[model samples]
Target chain A: MSRLSRFLKDNGISVVFGVGFLLSLIGQAFAGRAEFNEELQSDGARPVGFFEYVATSHFAVDITENWQSEYLQFFLFLFGTVWLLQRGSPESKEMHKAGLESDKDQRVGPHAREDSPRWAAVGGLRQTLYSRSLGIVMLTAFLGSWLAQSISGAAALSEERLRGLQEPVPWASYLLSADFWSRTLQNWQSELLAVGSMAIFAVYLRQRGSPESKPVGASHDATGIEG
Target chain B: MRTIARLAVLTLVVGVPLTGCAVPQDRLEAVRKATERFATLHTAGDFRAACALLTSAAREEAVHNGGPTCAQALADAELPEPGAIRSTDVYGRQARVELATDTYFLTSFPGGWRISAAGCTPREGRPYRCLLKGD
Candidate 1:
């Protein structure tokens, strides 16, 4: 294959999602700017330009709130699946294989295959870190995004309060406010529900060739068997 | 590890507005000074000077209210003394300065911070009612 084609093939999933995210973000900017300008006009304030609106706390908070929740969902899933078992769900490991398996079972240490990751072949802190790296990274992203949401949300809330002739709150106060919790919980509940539903649905559903689903001919009780 | 680091860097980049885009202290101080000057000009009976400090929108509204000029309208408004500055809060291009006796809302323009509303009194669950306000 040509270099361009080889690169595309190797990174197709990321490229697709990256492009989709950019398009969606652009769409959000246009829609958000229009809605923001409408409210500004109604309040007798000057309308902001598209770039200005995008840079505002109003936009930042909205994006960060959703991003944080998504990272939280993946973080929970990655950590939860390590010990939790769902008998019929391909999303989970086999029921008998629950909990952290032996080092040999994980192809670590003496049992490491020649193709195994270097850290997996090592024994000590590096191996330990590599084992939980997925969960660690997801958790880190979750915390970072949550922090971003809080900061941006506080700024947005302060602007609204100032517009209403109320005193603008400090970051600590805003973090404890109903507005902050409302934004967080609203996104969180949706993400949690979607993840839970997907886990349960995968037990009975078959998506043919998708790894997320069991094979069409597979039994409903078959655990940890991906198509 | 590299992927995680890249993800973190990307998030921080996106978080620029949240992490370090706070309204600068210098900008807040400039607004505070402008507010004090406005109150000082009004208290000194320099209505024209005070009127000159009003935002264009506010000045136009003041002029159209009753008097033919912003100065005449402001002089007729009978605003209370602002006294010493108590506190000032600046968010983005907007600011609110609380004086010992009154509150004022200011908006930043290319020229500088100008009074959008003066002689303001807060109302519960509503925007402040002001003797001089932009339309």
Candidate 2:
């Protein structure tokens, strides 16, 4: 029992995230198939097999749009935190201390702890680059997801045009069209709203044992540091 | 009362020219032919030729798939066979047709009656249950 508690304390987040991701994927497959079948009936076309629809850009676009927004949320939050601060919010650093901090504050070279990463101790450009690696990776992933949304979105739109006995547009034209931007903007707005809420809510909210929130009794005026 | 009667007469005079021209059946025929030709090209696996016949909406879709040149249909490997119109029922600018394997719903375009949409199903448990194709 003691060992189990210790293991969960160390690896709780990784487990929850992995399990939730897999379950949602399965749910999407089932729900997507149902929706595809509805369209098929509406078009008078035969309902496609489950796996067949799964391979198409229809499913690809659906999944990528979701992934794009999630990555966008994370990427924006990571970088935004560096430049913006809410003085009393645990979710943000102090207002006066915006932007990159000094080397000693971040711990580098001889000032590094014994357990500090090798790159942090190496200083120079390597240390500087490593300092922002999390945001970089998240931003790269968001860009990739957004690109995939464009490609897959074009494919889905083309299929609809073909089915409608209409001429298809060029990829460049589709990218510039109202249809593509509408889809992107709709998803982006929701993610922005959610992230903005989190930043504000975490200021006075407490989730007890959750690392996402400060201690239950912590002052609403507390800033930057976690419980 | 006299002014009101005069205004009513004037309104009737203006309403006479308000009706728009109806779409001609010949135009619908031309659009149907164009759509059929495109479908024929697709079934024959001559995607480039088929793509050329595609309406603006379909053409946009094809271009997104890679260069609007490939014969891949339905995003699945299964190839749909080309079919001919068995019979057509035209009403004003709208028409529904029964093809060899599917039913097509059409609307008149500038050129002729073109299929606005088409749906296909197997022979048994066929598309008839949910379609408006035949009489």
Candidate 3:
């Protein structure tokens, strides 16, 4: 196959999700703008334009709150998998091979093969850093988005207060407010539930060709047996 | 590897420069001017001109409560006396201007900041009680 075809085939999943993310985000912008304008109309304010509405705290808070939760979900899942195990779920490590495994299994230091990553072959701080980079990045993204959510959420709440002729709370005060926690915990619980459900469901479920699930014929008790 | 790329995104939004994008220099002036004009007109008993400085909702509320016309409603509402403008808080399309004796809530219409409510007093743990409020 040609290089472009190979690249497309190899990266199809990432590409599909990336495209979907953009499309959905664009859809959200349009939908959010409509609702925002309706709100403005009810408040006797002039309707905002597309780009204008996008820059509003209202829109920023909505997007960041969701982003933070997603990152938190991914981060927790990635980090949790290291020492976590589920007997028959592909989402978990094999019960017997849990807890970071042996050095040879991870191919670091002297056990690194020729095809191994440079950090894995060099083996030290770089190796350790490379090994945990995915989880670290996810954790960082979760924290960053959570920070963004708080900032924007406070601003949005303040705007709402001003609109309602109530005083705007300071950001520090808003940190302790129910609105912030509700936005956070609501998204978190849903994501946690989704990951929790997926992990357990894979134990009894069979997706014949999907790596996420065990083979159709695989025993329900077979741990971490992927397609 | 793309730290700069991520930083740019964060600066633009992840850290959200969306709210209180305080273009304070000109927008504050506009808010102050609209508010001061409303106060001056109301004090001068030019209720017609004062009524023009209100949001459509506020105007409608006035017309509904005490009107045959908006000016007559304003004349009847007997909102508290406006004092000198103290401070203005502008957030996106909304603003809250604190005057010496009263507080006013405004919204940025295409025509500029218009009073949505005036003669507002804070009530702890609740929305402000405004003498002249939008519907």
Candidate 4:
């Protein structure tokens, strides 16, 4: 295989998901544009084209709201596993290994192996930062997306209000509105439920070939064991 | 982490709404001009000219197919005396122009802005009560 082919083969799952994301986003833009135009027509406004709809806050809010929740789910999962444990699930560390493990166990600082990342072998802030980079990045993405949602959300709402000949609410005031919390919590609840259910389900369930599950024949009480 | 998160949110909160809205100045001026013309024509008792400035839906509301013609209906409805145009706010393809005595709601068409509602007065928290409206 060529170098590019080797790289694609090495990251097959990410490549597939990346392609899927693009396809779904394009699909969303088309569907969203149609729906948006229908709404505009009802309001006695002119129908916007596809490109115009894509630039609208209605589209931005829809995209960012989902992105924020997904990022929050991953951020919580990554950060939670350090201190929280589910004894019989591969999704968690062993009960005895709960909380940030010893530096030696984590192979950080003086205990890092020769091939370990340079930051992992260093001490001080760099080591601390590299250690929690995944969770930090995920959390940051969640906050940024949520903020974007709020900005676009305020604009979209204002557009609706304008259609009705009502004055637009200020962005600061919109943050306190029921609509803001409603959108945020609606997505958060579903994600939290899914992760919570998965954690508990993996305690007893088994999948033979998947790394996300323990060996089918492994003891049901086994923890932190992959197929 | 907290600082970064707060900064990201703060940047967007203060920045996006202010900078994101880029309504074309020409479109806004067009809306304002259309609103003033509707008011001007109505004030001059040029109901035929005024009827031309109304949206198709608003014209229908005025005539209702079974009613008198649009110009005749406007001559009889006794809509408020439209005062001088004050301000025009255009959001997307819709606009609301505040006049000295009334509010006019308009929608942008290929031809230009056309009044969908005219001689509208505030009704507390409810939608404006207009002498003429589309829906």
Candidate 5:
């Protein structure tokens, strides 16, 4: 019991992310396969096996479009925090604080009393970049998902032509079509609405002890920090 | 007196039509009827019967393409019941009729009209593209 508890305590975040990813992927496979078969049966077409279906871009676009939007939300949030502030909201920094805080305030460089990360002290551009490293990683992930969407969307388009007993359109043309944009924008809208609403709502709402919200006792006008 | 009056009315109706020449059946009406019959068979999941109604050229093409025997092909299909005509759109010799599970694009054949293609289901994993035929 103790060993399991210790392992979970030390690796809870990793475990959560890993399991969530696995379940999400499994869900995509099942739903996508069912929808695919339904369409095939309607057209007097053959149904593809699971692994083969996964290899096609139809699945790729289905997954990547959502992934890109999620990463974009986090990336935007990370960078937006730098200059944007909402008074009394735990999501933002103080109203007037802008750019990176001081090294001493951040507990690194010459201000380190010895427990500081080795890289934090070995400063210059490395330290400068690390200051906003969260944003960088999120932005990189967002770009990756976007690229995956385009590649998969093209493959899906070609498959459609083949089924129609017509010549397949090239990947380049598919990328520019209304179908692709419509799918992308539809997903993007939902993500944007969620993020935008949460940012504004956190200003007035309070959840005791939760880092996502200010403490109930905190003043309604408080700009940053957990109340 | 009643018998005479009834006979006079019957003669009036029969004589009016025969007086000149009989009216012709509109070509559009004949075409529409054929299309309706085609859609009815398809929606009932009777692909063989439906294929039998096709023009000879289409039947040849289906066989040449290595498609399943018509009955076998229909076994996996999902369709509305027979006698339901969702919609019918005609353009001269070509027409498109949307049934519950299939949208058939047909051409005027010697027998009447035969389906050139059915556009209903999208390609597997590619829901945006309609799959009309076997890959």
Candidate 6:
């Protein structure tokens, strides 16, 4: 394959998602600006420019809220699947393979293959950290995004309060307020529902080539089977 | 992958505070001065001067609320003394200056900060009921 074709094949998933993210973000900006301007007009305020709208807490909160929820969903899935078993679901490990398996099964330390990661090969705090790195990373992303959402949401809500000639609460107060929890829980509930449904659906569903689903010919009772 | 993750974490850490509750010192000072100027003009009974320092919407609303002109309406309203500025909270173009006796709301235009409301009293779980609120 040509270099371009090779690069495309190698990085197709990332590229596709990245492009989709950009397009969706751009579309959101335009739509949000229009909606914002309409409100501004009704409120006797001047319409903001596209760039200015993008920089506002309104846009920041909306983006970060969604991001935090997605990361939270992934974080829960990553950690939960390690301990919780969903029988016959392609998304889960085999029924007998619950909990952290043996060192031999994991191929760490003495059992580490040459191709294994350096941290995995070594036995120490590094190995312990590397063992749970995926969960750690997901948790970190979720926390970071959630914090971002809170900060930006507070700012946005404060502006609205100010517009209404009300007292703008401090960031700390906002974090503790119902507005913050409402925004967080609303997104979180939807994300959790999607994840739970996906897990349950995969038990009976089949996708011909997708690794997320069991093979078309795979038995419904076959656990941990992926295409 | 590690580098990307680190960058994302760093961005979130830094971007949150930068994007959140950032009112520039200079802008705050400017808003403070504008509030002081409005108070001075209004307290001195120079209603025209005070009216001049109001947002166009506010001026229109002031006129519509009371007398035929903005100044006439403001003079008729008999706004109370604002006293010293206790605190100020600014969010984007809108700012609230809390005085010893009352609160005033200001909005920034291309020229400078203009009074949007004054002699504002808080209503529970609602927008402040301002004596001279903008439309």
Local distance difference test values of all predictions, in order: 0.84, 0.63, 0.85, 0.83, 0.63, 0.89
The TM-score, computed over Cα atoms with residue i paired to residue i, of candidate 4 is 0.82
Which digits, one per residue and each the tens of the lDDT, describe model 4 over residues B14-60? 44343335577898899989988988888799999999999888899
**Per-candidate interface C-alpha RMSD?**
3.0, 19.4, 2.7, 4.0, 26.0, 1.4
After aligning candidate 1 to the native by TM-score, how far in Å is the CA of B125 from where it should be? Answer: 5.7
- Of all true interface contacts, what fraction is found in model 2? 0.02
- List runs of model 5 lying over 4 Å from the truth: B1-135
Residue lDDT tens for model 3, A34-97 = 9988986786557889998888888888888998899889989988888888888988878888
Mark the 10 consecutive residues where model 4 chain B has the least summed lDDT: B11-20
Q: Candidate 1, overall lDDT? A: 0.84
Superposed on all Cα atoms, the candidates' RMSDs to the truth, in angstroms, are 2.5, 21.1, 3.0, 4.7, 24.2, 1.8
Error of 2 at A193 (Å): 1.1
Candidate 1 chain B lDDT trough over 10 residues, lowest sum? B12-21
**Model 2: DockQ against the native?**
0.02
For model 3, what fraction of the real interface contacts is kept? 0.45
Per-residue CA lDDT of candidate 5, range B1-135, in tens?
579656644533333223112212464456556667766676676778877765444455555554566544443444334344576544323444555665555555445655555545434455323223222
Sort by TM-score, best first.
6, 1, 3, 4, 2, 5
DockQ of 1: 0.39
lDDT of 4 by residue, A163-194 (tens): 78676656798899887889999999999999
Off by over 4 Å in 1: B1-10, B17-21, B60-68, B121-129
**Candidate 1 residue-wise lDDT, A22-117, digit = tens:** 899999989988987897677566678877788788888888888889889999998898899888999999988878999889999999999999
Of models 4 and 6, which has the larger TM-score?
A: 6
User: What does candidate 2's lDDT look like per residue over A19-48, in tens digits?
Assistant: 898799889988998997798568544465
User: How many clashing pairs does model 1 include?
Assistant: 0
Total clashes in model 3, counting residue pairs 3 or more apart in sequence or in different chains:
1
What is candidate 6's lDDT per residue for B1-135, written digit by digit as tens?
789867767877667646876778999999999999999999999999999999988899988889799899999987889999999888877899999988999988889999999999888988998899888
State the fraction of real interface contacts model 1 keeps.
Answer: 0.17
The global Cα lDDT (0 to 1) of model 4 is 0.83
